[model samples]
Target: MPQANIDPAIKSVHVFSTGAGEQHKEHRYGSPLPRLLWALTSQSWIKIPVNAFVIEHRDGLVLFDTGLDPAIKSDPNYINSAIGRFLLRRIFRLHIGPDERLHKKLEAMGFAAADIRKAVISHLHFDHVGGIADIPQADLLVSKDEWAQLSAPHPEREWILREHIEIPGAKWRPVEFAPTDDPLFAPFGGSYDVMGDASMILLPTPGHTPGSMSMLVRTGDTPPLLLVGDLTYQADLLMKDQVPGTGDAKLLRSSFAKVRTLKKQFPDLVILASHDPETADILAASHSSRP
Candidate 1:
């Protein structure tokens, strides 16, 4: 039986990157920062589209990341947490109108947030999981170890939140892939295969954080798409093998290197970068019907 819920006509698919800013506007374009870190990307902010995905397979539907907090659009300067949030909308030169939240967009497309059965997180960063609250019935997926790390985090680790992880009444499913150092597909080795449905697989890319993952969507036996969350802020950087501009240079460096190799090996995979503007172009072109 063809899955009635998921639009199977769109066999292999992707979601567009929605955000409020640009990448390396300081470095490639021009800004007032002297060092690469501050110049390339804001350590305190990023103008990235929370890249999310929706996959339709024979059995079910799978969602990638949930995206940024809809609240930011209301009060682009509303980061009332302890660490205090950077006004990304202002920093990115984005003017968030009242109507721009993921759920709004989803509802507009004739789908509700609760319709999502599974969601794969690249990492637990706020921008990635900010819309988690909007997704009511999803079996939220992330590395089990990563969840632990997010909860019992290292000191001064100003990113993740316990509330996001332990949302009351949410169906959170922690997935682990450490024991199997096997390649995501087979023969190759390094991640966990979400054991087919042509659904989603979680790659164990632990660098952007302790359990960063790149989502692999298998539409068919011949090809797939790789939605890497913050793996490389830009696909151009990953293609160039250049060390990415990240919070921790060294950690990001190592992670960047591995993904670079993966890209080299599987060039056919449709790759998406959360903050990269290019992803919007690619995804829009791929599924113009939805956008």
Candidate 2:
């Protein structure tokens, strides 16, 4: 079969690894017994990359997620509360360095932190929003439901830390999805067109967190990409309707079904997850395949 040409207007798409870390398999899969057993007997850890996607849109530079902050590993006060710190260690293992900071990573990719005009936040998880402070000038967009969590007392309990998100001088914009006439996005019920050109469309996927979202990127020369943030540890799992250990399983299933429908509609659609190990290689292939 002949290959399809992608949008020439999209200069390039780049993926950066903010850091590399590992989490218990049980924490990634489901159920409490396995996690307890692993805590007691096993030492298996699944390596995953904390990733952020950068798109070279014609209008400006846009980021899918901000990735992680190196401070989490370097600073003792990163988590703030002692209890939070204790829980964090029990759940995962992080291996990050000073050079892995968002700004530095962007610099390594030939982009400046100031070049990011818009940032689509998948959710308020500390790992995803860790670099928001690095780009205070960028318009940070988050779903209204996700932003609402910040107003509740101690959102950090749910991993949505206000201390990092509510930082001074940050441009936070909470957006609501509107009905879309486009059938391609009909499964999502509504969509938010980030660039108003169908180049990047934001669809609410929820499940992992109340306002979790996935980004649909369409370029003339490349297959559409659905950047799902922590929706599932892997894209294959999502296709099989395997819900992760964290998050609302029912909601995850509902979101998973919607994503499956999207795949049915656009078979070549690439679903990119935040923690997926293949994101870097897949993104590189996408770029290489571009016209």
Candidate 3:
């Protein structure tokens, strides 16, 4: 779709981290070792941001992801299941202060948590949904495929905790992608426009999880952005077709190809992964050079 055809309802896009964490190098990049083996034995660790993006749309404030919850550190029973808790310790070393909570992060940005009208959840991962509690009034949007995992036997095994997600007063909406003739999004099969004006569109890019999706932000003069949550740790890796250690390899490749095709269409596309540490800088630079 041409830029002129779509209204520029988005004022700005901002990114902030609720916290940071250390994951094994094998997790970020590809590894031959099995996920369990690497989680237990890998010595290499990479620090990553637990990022969330705030889109200043004409309607109201929208969030791409909620970032990590501080209770995961302060509360012993955060994961509930003993085995889940044990596995989590081996997988991640989180560094989040009480002040780094979602509401506090938004406050620092001069926004109230209540100002969030909707949050387009990239997936049902803990880190991505952690801040939902802080914004009970906002609608939490997740792809229908991703939400189906809750019905499966053991979603918690995949680090999808129902206790936190199915909380009281939480507005969880399952999004179904509709057929679109728009050539730019046709390769993705379908899409869900977060805002009616198409300032932001959600595309199903599963592989990181069954229901994983990414957001495409097209505003006025700023470069277009794809807010990919854990599809890849870094944008360059996705460009190289490098699959992470976990998730379905076959499916990841499929999603990677679609995103790569999108990049070719919009040469200046800014691909921002949720955990990519360089996201904030890249976002700033993209806007700084905007025509």
lDDT of candidates 1 onward, in order: 0.60, 0.85, 0.93
Candidate of highest lDDT: 3
Per-model TM values vs. the true structure: 0.75, 0.93, 0.98
Model 3: runs farther than 4 Å from truth? none
Clashing pairs in 1: 18-49, 19-49, 182-190, 183-188, 183-189
- Please identify model 1 stretches exceeding 4 Å from their true place: 1-12, 17-19, 22-48, 73-78, 86-95, 153-157, 181-190, 221-223, 284-291
Taking all chains together, the TM-score of candidate 3 against the true structure is: 0.98
Residue-level lDDT of model 2, residues 1-291, one tens digit each, is: 112333345677888878888987876776556444554444668898988899999988999989888889888998878878877777778888887888999998899999999999999999899899899899999999899989888887787878888899999999999998777678788999898777788999999999999998887677778899999988899998888878888999999999999888878778888999998888767655645
How would you encode candidate 3's per-residue C-alpha lDDT over 1-291 as one tens digit per residue?
A: 377666889998999998899999999998999999999998888999999999999899999999998999999999989999999988999989877889999999998998999999999989999999999999999999999999999999999999999999999999999999988899999999988888899999999999999999999688899999999999999999999999999999999999999998888899999989999999999997766
Give the lowest summed-lDDT range of ten residues in model 3.
1-10
Instruction: Please estimate how well model 2 matches the true structure, expressed as its whole-model Cα lDDT.
Output: 0.85
Q: What is the lDDT of residue 5 in candidate 3?
A: 69
lDDT (tens digit, per residue) of candidate 1 on 112-176: 67676677887887667767777778778887767777557442244575655567877777886
Q: Which candidate is the best by TM-score?
A: 3
Q: Rank the candidates by TM-score, best first.
A: 3, 2, 1
Q: In model 3, what is the error at residue 190, expressed in angstroms?
A: 0.5
Q: What is the C-alpha RMSD of each candidate to the true structure, in Å?
A: 5.8, 2.7, 0.9
